[model samples]
Every structure is written in structure tokens, then in C-alpha cells.
Target chain A: MNKILSTVVLMALVVVGCVRQDESVIRIGAAGPMTGDQSKMGIDLRNGVELAVSEWNEKGGVLGKKIQLVPGDDQADPKQAVSIANKFINQKVAAVVGHWNSNCSINASTYYHTANIVAISPASTNPRLTQQGYKTIFRVCGTDDQQGGVAAEFVLKTLKPKRLAIVHDNTTYGKGLADFFKQVIENKVQVVYYDGIQTKDPDYKAVLTLIKEKKPDVYFFGGVYPEAGRLVRQAKEVGMAIPMVTGDGVYDPTFISIAGNAAEGTYVTFGKDPSGLPTSKAFNEKYTAKFGAPGPYSVYAYDAANIILTAMQKTGTTEGTAVAAYITKNSFPGAFGDISFDKNGDVTKAPYVVWKVTDGKFVEMK
Target chain B: MFTQQLINGLALGAVYALIALGYTMVYGILQLINFAHGEVYMLGAYLGIIVLGVLTYWGLTAYSLVLSLLVTVIVSMAFCAAYGAVIERVAYRPLRNAATLTPLISAVGMSIVLQNFVMLAQGKEYKNMPPKLPTEGFNLLGANVSPVQIFILTASILMMVALQLFVAKTRLGKAMRATSQDRVMAGLVGININQVISTTFMIGSSLAAVAGVMVTLYYGVVHFSMGYSAGLKAFTAAVLGGIGSIPGAMLGGFMLGLIENFGASYLSSAYKDAFAFLVLIITLILRPSGLFGQKAMDKV
Candidate 1:
């Protein structure tokens, strides 16, 4: 019994000493909705960072040292994200790669800034995060305006629907995307209506009723799947004669299951076509082999992780300042595409891809 | 749009009524609120999700929704009822002889503990009941209403009617009312107050289970922390309707729902919560017994 207790004590001591304050192991912090509505995003970010670490460690880690990925669940709550940011600072992590929601990333940015910690987000698209001019912040994804511009141009120049109704969740991403779509399409097409919905309330029939009344040829929702699916079904019931469209947040299996046949004609935006892209085929095989499901943000997260590891290798330091400098200075090939952060922490004018939901598969728009 | 808002309100009201019934039943008897009651409601949602996941894993989607919902309801009720009884025995019963504030504080602690337990187990993910409740809308007087709304209303009314009949006719129901009225008198009369209280928990927890499943079916997914927000809303509904009255709780729930829906449509959607509480405050000020509450003031 004495030997067993001593052995247990020794193991605990070794583990504690392993994570010593001055250890070479670089701790990378990632914050996302690990348990809530945007869990897929968090899962994707987790998988991406995990794969990046494994790949980097396999090829000899940055500066001849191992990399440790630290993930914090923010549950997509802005306050929780802020709290996690403070925790990350207290933990003295080298860098952070996280936060899909703009609201979360925005709140977490101030903390990373205060601590001079380098932060890289894979999918927070709100322009304000960049416009805030926080030097510590970086993003792998484009802003709402850029996404809207690409999507709006494609819609007008390609699909050419007669009348389009725009809707949003009235949050940073939702409202930002809706406003950009509105600005881009108002001159080119007959914009029918702009509406905003709440987060928790179950019904969207009123909006659907209004949509049916307006008889818009097309409907675009700047929100996630839970609300979008309801809107789609309610529109069909109320006989809303419109093809539904959405931002990237709506491209999930949940949307198809909820809307069922109503989801057939829906169009959504994507950063890359999962099948057509080289990374998609590779990541698809690996992810299916590993997690059994190819989560929507998996590739983007994989690329974000890849970028951080590549920067760590180039800078020869897991130090935030060094990594950020190397990341901004260098363009690295990623799962989605070649990624290089501009001064404002976003991909320099990347275009968004449009995908149509057909038979529950993301068929790339021709 | 006004009619549409009213219909939406009625559907929401039914949901609030069912949830409030669970709370009011417990409060009516023990005067000790089971804060973990919401967690039980949340557990019911998780039960439904787990059942669906298992069924989906086994390719049981071909099974009718009625059958699936039935399984969900039974499993959720069983789980929550067990949890409710355990919570009462362990948390509330310990503080039975303590001051009134002691039990209330213990209830709050239990609520936090239960919520955190769920958070630890499920993480911080926002889960829904599943499939985002049926999207089919039925027309009501030139206004569109979802089948989910109709489903919630019909099921809740049926539950209320059944509860009323049970409490009026059943021997156990009479014991429950007796105990609720005077625990000492009922105990002297050989009512077995313990059994009455346990039965009260069983009934209330079962109602919460039904509400839990209905909420998930209505929203289409279940999350771990969904109980906290919705539970608070339902508690407000109970208080608004008169905490001790069954029918009043139901009426208050519907009224709160209607007010929230209309407030969202015409006023700010963000302020819908504000409107719900506003209704509660106004009711407290004007008619404290609630819209359907029966006043039986007694002085010892």
C-alpha cells in the first residue's frame, strides 16, 4: 500500500512537472461552442487543431518542441468567451486559434489584445473584429461584407431571381451579412423586404406569412439552421413562392432534416467546395476514417491549425508576437486554399463559393 | 398578423401552462420550490434526444412520430420522476425542519448543482429536442398556425383535463388536496402525508416530463442548459397564474405567451422577456390570485 501510494504520488509529480511554467511545450488556446447550437463549428475547430498538432509533431514540432492544443468551450456565449479569454491569459498560452461566432471572437479579442496574445479565428466573419484594429487578432475567414459581395455578385450575375427578401437574426454575423447583401443587391435587383428574428423563440411563421404575402421570388436568410429550417417549412405551408438562400451557417444536415423536402431548392454559401477542392478529398477521407462525419467547418478548422503550425515552424518560436509576424509575412497552403493574413487579420479579399442543397448533398454551383 | 400572433401566443401559453403545472403542484403542497424541477425538464429533453439518437442509429426513423414521441415521453417521465423523488428526499427533506429560507436556499443550490452536472456531462453545447418540431402550419381563421402549436395546445389541454379529473375523483388525489390544505390535519386523519407529498412530486415531475418532450418536439432540439431559461420562464408563468392554483397557472402561461409573441411582433423582439415579466408584475399588482385563481384566505 505504501509503494502504491508513493508510485501514485510520483506519477502526479511527473505530470505536474511536465507542464512546468518554463516548459517548451507550446499551449495553443481554442475557444468555441463545444456543446451548443454551433457545436459542429467547435468540433471542426477541435479536429483541425488536433490534426495540425499531430502532423506538426510527426514532422518534428516547431523549434524542436512539442505543441499542446488547449480548447475552451465558450458555448457561443459572449460573456463566457470573455471569461475563457481571461483564463487563457492566466494560463499563459503561447497562442489561440478559435471562436467561430463573431460575437464570441469579438469579446475574446480585447483579452488577447490586453495580454498581447496572438489570436487566430477560422470562421468569425464580422468586419468589426478587424476594424477594431487589434493587432493581436487574425482570421482565416473573410468578413461579412466580403462574403456578401461574393454571394450577391453571384446571385445577381447568375441566378437572377426577380424579387428577393432578406432576413437576419439581428446579431453581428446575421445583421452584417444581411446589410451587405442588401447594399450589394438593392441597385441590381428588386429587394422586397428586410426582416430580423430573435434567437430562442421557436416560430418564424409571422415572417413566413409576411414572405408569402410579399410573394418574393427568392428568400435569403442571414442566420443559422434552427431558425432557417423553420422559416423554410413555414414558407412552403403558407405558399411563399420563393427559392430560399442562406449564408454558410445554414449548410448542415440539421437544416435538411428539419426542412425535409423544403430544403431541396435552398442555396448556401461556402468557403470551398468539399468535393471539388483537393483538401476536401483528403480531409474527407481522413475525417471519415477518424470521426465518421465530415463536419461543415472541419476543413476550415484544419486549415487554421495548419496555418498556426506552419507559422510556428517558420518563426522557430511559439511566442505570439513571433508567430503572428511569421503568419502575416508568409502565405502557407491550407486545406481550403493558400492562406495569408493581411494587416487586419483576414484573408486578403478571398471570394466565397455558392453551394446548392440537392438530395442532401452539397452540390457545387456550376 | 394580430391573429397570427394570438395563435402563436396560445401555443406558447400551452407550453408555459404545462411547465407551470409542474412547479405549482410542488409549491402548492410543500411550499418548497424544487429549483431542480427545471433540470428534470431538461433531463426529459436529453432523454428524448438520446432515444432519437439510438433509434436513428438503429434506422428506426420509419417508426411513426407518435410511437417515437410516446417512447420519449415514457422514458423522460420515468427518468425525471425518479430524479424529482431523489432530489426531494436528499435536498428538500433534509432542510424540512430548518427555516423557510433554508429550504429555498437549498433548492437554489440543488438547481445550480444539477445545471452544472449537466454542463459537465454534455459540455456547453446548445442542443434542441430534434428535427426542429414539425414545420406543417394549419390555417386558423385566415392566420397561419403550425401543427406544433396545435399539438402543444391539444396535448396540454388534455393533460389539464386529465389532472383535474384525477384530483377530483381518485382517492390518492383527495389525499393530495387534504395534505396540501393542512398537512397536520391530513396526517391525523391517516392521510400518510409522505405518500401525498411523494405522489405530488410524481405527478408534477410527470407533467414536467411531458412539457420537456413537447418543448423539444416544438423546438426540434434539446440542449443541456435549455432548462434554466425555459424553466425560469415557466416559473414566471406559474407565479403569474397564481402559484397554488392549477387552472390559473395554465391561464397565466397562455397569457404570458400571447403577450410575448405580440410584443416581439410589434415591439422589440429583444424585449419579449421584459414583456413576460411585465405581465407577471402587473398581475401581482392587480390580481395576485391570477386570472383563474380561487381565493380561500384563512387566518389561524
Candidate 2:
């Protein structure tokens, strides 16, 4: 009889533990690659989300409850992204701001739509991500279609080379950007050499030599910072000194550091510098004080988190469908400016600008 | 273009040969592949960065690039050698008499552990090796070869020659040969089997360290996962040349490098890695014992 009583006591404690976890707190999920090669970007995204959540909690949170952040690391992979989405759904988070990679965002959006949970991707740029028509999916960044077209316009009007060479890392984002650029410029100029390179290989001399032999007047590469750095460095090493242009994926401080002196004279297409705007001054100062400097996508992540929090406050409830519906129908002030999602769940006004690396710094090209 | 690609292929092959020697040496003695060997090479590169960073801070690099590089290479090689011995003792020595699969699994586990450990300690970003050498190069038939590439090729060749001499002429070398030939007989002759095995690992690891340092100088970038693809290619080179033969490994490394460069040049560059494996498959089917491997025989 004494043993049976102890067992009954243990079961009561378990029931109380589960109930306490769900009481008086609003949970928001943040997903990104918190580990692996892209962990730096992931950590930056997490930091941005944390800053926004903490600020909300300091303001007494939404509906008189404390705010909680649930972080999931997808490791920048698609399959892992689906698992993270399911986990967030099981945790019953009101909204999500995450999935930095385009592929991850695209894969996880299906589950979020099925569960009626809102997910706002801060950095995924592939056009297919928003083209899927998932009502629950949203993004703060511009699509590759816009980014690539901007780059192509710059190449044709500004650089105006007779022969151009295009290369990509063969990833979803890279290939998509390259293809879009090609669609715009294939008839205007001669594409001397076109190919895809394996990411993270660290040796591009073979391909660089081939491109050098072709004698293209300008070279364009569609990839992230790591491969971009290596490609330019190796191209310089191989005596191919042509000017190179790339998409926003190569627009990080890490690229300059990795490429060293070779980074000079390279052009990158990205959104206009938002840190200099008066609206973002406070966010920049707070972020810099906490995490050294804001990473390339930190501002977007901060805006994404704030969008979710504002939607929750206006709806006055943590229900997924209700909050998502309110977010789609309203405009909210963000770190960049006023952000309004279109019917397709994309930012309507994302302006792409070209920046040049001059004297080891990325300067906005007027 | 052909000459330039040839030069590029040679430089890449030299590094692969350096790494392949480690795989070949370990397999020569214990008949077990050290999957953790690549991690050792990676650690060697990280060590190079740390030491080089310190030297640069003290202005030693500015004083003399050659001296600073020499000190960095020596220090990194020493540390990696010790690391290799510890790995062998803790992970491989205990399973020496167990099923061959046991140590193989342990090797893979150790590789994962080391890779993660470095990732955590170094922060997952790619650490740039501050360029100490001049990038200027001499042009030959429209192909420019940088000074750093020349340094890599010369350093690799010198170390390989030194290794060949050490193995053929030293007392320790003779004991290693005896142990590889017949461990029981060598132990009966009062040879210290443990010491011989440790020495082999030390030499192999130091060679890999040298290769690691060379790679950083050549590429000017290094990361935690750099070892995985490099180690895989070096392992392929070792098997293609003959798993246990030193000279065969060198020959195989160069051939694979040239094949990859030419294949990428003439065909699709995206399939660059695939070419190495294709050659590996054809080699395996055409000559099961490899190019230089002796035919297998059953003991009576």
C-alpha cells in the first residue's frame, strides 16, 4: 500500500510539470543553422531574434504575458528543416522567424502551411520560396529574381563587357540567381564560359584556368561568400584580372577578409545600406553593443521577429491562424522601414542596389 | 593553358602525396586505415594559423618570412605528431587484437570528435591565413606560377626525399619493416613493437602536418571540414598507388591530380570530384591489387 501511494505521487508531479510549462508565456520559434559551416549566420539570426524577444518581454510582453523564444537549428539542410518545423508545430509556437537558407525555407513552409503557423524567412532569397503560394509563409528579403535582374542591368549598362563568363556553386540559390541573370543577358552579350563549381572545395584553379583561356571581359559568380572569396583570390593568382560581379550572397565582411587584397574592385548587388537610416540607428547600436557588429542578415531577422511580435500584440491572442491572418492584412514598422506583406506573403518594396569593394570596404555605388 | 593546368595539377598532387604517405604508412604497419588521419592534417593547419598568428604579432614574420614559416611548420608538426600518437594509443592500440572492424569504427568516431572539437574551439568560420609570401609569379607559355606554389612543390619534394631516406637507412626504419612483415617474429626478436608503431604514426602525422601547412600557404584559407574531402582524395590516391607502398602513393597522388585537372579542363568542371572516383573504380576493376600492390597470398 505504501509503494502504490509513492507511485501515485510521482504521476501527479509529472502532470503538474507539463501544465506549468504551458502557463502564462507566449512562445515564438526561431529556426536557422545554429551549427556547421553556416553557424555564424545562424548565430547572428538567433541573436537578432533574442534581442527582439527580450525587448518585448521588457515591455511586459503581449496580452500581459512573458515572451519565450524557441530556437531550432536546421543546419542549413532541407530535411533537417522539415524536422525543425514539425518540432515547432509540436511546441505550438504562435509564429516563426527563421530558416536562412532558401532551400530550408522552401522545404519547411509546407509543414507550416499545413499547421496554419506563420513563418517569416529573413534571408531565403530564392523566388520559388514565395512562388509556392503558401498563405502561412512570408519573407522580409527580396527574391533572387529581383536581385539577379539588378545585377544583370548593372553588368549591361555599367560594365558593358563584350564577352561575359558566368559561374555558380550549383546550389538552389546560386543556380537560380545565375539562371535569372543569364535570362536577361544571354542575348545582349556573348557568354564566353558558363559552369557550376563545387562549393567548399577551396581549389578553383582548374576552372579559373579555363575561364582565363576564354578571355572573357567580365566574370560573374553566383555563390555565397566562402566560395566567392576563394574564386576571386584564385582568379587573381591565376593571372585573370578581369572585374567580377556577384549577388548578395557575397556581400559580407567575411568575404573581404577571406579574399584579402583580391576583394578590391569586385561588385556585389544587395539591398541598400539600412544601417545608415535613422530608423535603424537604435537597432544597430543595440546589436553592435551585444554582438560586435550586425551580420549581413541580422537586421532582416530583427525585423522579422518584430513583425511576428507586433502581429501577436494586435491580434491579442497566440492562436496561429488568427495571428497569421492579422499579419497578412496589416503594415508594421520595422528596423528598415514600414514592412507590408503582399497577398503572396512577400515584401512589396525591396530595392536592390550595387555596392563596390573599394579600399577593403563595401561602399554603396551611387 | 595546358602548361598552367599542369603546374596547378602538380602542386595539388604534391599535397595529396604528402597526405597519402600518412595513410600508406599506417596501413603498411597495422593493415588498418586511420580515418582520423585527415583530422590530424586539419589540426595541423589550425596549429599553423595559431603559431603564424603569434609570430606575426611579434613581428617575426615581417623580419623574415622563411624563418617564421620554418618555426611555425616545426611547432605544428611536433604538436600533430604527439596528437597522432595519443589517438593511436587511446583509440587503436586497445583494439589491436580485436576484429578489424572495431578499430575502423573507432577511427571514424575519433574523426567526428576531432572535427567537432575544432569547430567548437575555432568557431565555424573560415580562418584566413595572412599572406606572408608574395603572390607575384613568373609566366611560362602564358601560364603564371606563383611563388607560393613553387614553395609548396619544393617543400613537399624535400620532405618526401627525407622520408624515403629515413625509412630505408635508419635502425628504427628496419624495425618498422620487420614489424610490418611479421609482428610476432619481430617481437620474438626483442623489438619494441609499441615503440615502432608509435614512431610510424609520428612520422606519418608530421608529414600530414607539413602538407596541411603547405595547403594554407597555397590557398590562403582553412576551415574545419577542409580535411574531409582532402582526406578522402588522399585515401583514394593511396589505394590507387598500392595501399602499403610509399613510392606507389606518391605516383598515384600525382596521377589523380593530373587526371582531375585535365578532366575538369576538357569536360565539365562540376564533375571534378567524380573523375577521381571514376579512375579509382577503373583501377580497382582492372588491377584488384592496385598499380604497385603485390598479389595476395594465403599463408599455409
What fraction of the reference interface contacts is present in each model, in order? 0.18, 0.63
lDDT by residue for model 1 over A95-140, one digit each (tens)? 8888878889999998898888888888888889877888768888
Q: lDDT of candidate 2 vs native?
A: 0.89
Say which docking band candidate 2 falls in. medium
Q: Can you write out model 1's per-residue Cα lDDT over B144-234, one digit (the tens) per residue?
A: 6776677777888988999999989999989988888888899999988877888788788888888877777665656666787778888
TM values, all candidates: 0.85, 0.93
Q: What is the lDDT of residue A193 in candidate 1?
A: 75
TM-score of chain B of 1: 0.92
- Best lDDT goes to which candidate? 2
lDDT of 2 by residue, A234-338 (tens): 888777899889998888888988898899999999988988899899999999998889988889999999998888888887776787788789998887789
Best prediction by TM-score? 2
lDDT for B9 in candidate 1 is: 76
Error of 1 at A297 (Å): 2.2
- Model 2 complex DockQ against the native: 0.63
Local distance difference test scores for all models: 0.77, 0.89
Question: Model 2: runs farther than 4 Å from truth?
Answer: A1-24, B57-63, B295-300
Worst-scoring 10-residue span by lDDT in model 2 chain B:
B291-300
For residues B208-263, write the lDDT of model 2, one tens digit per residue. 99988988888888899889989999999999998888998998888888988988
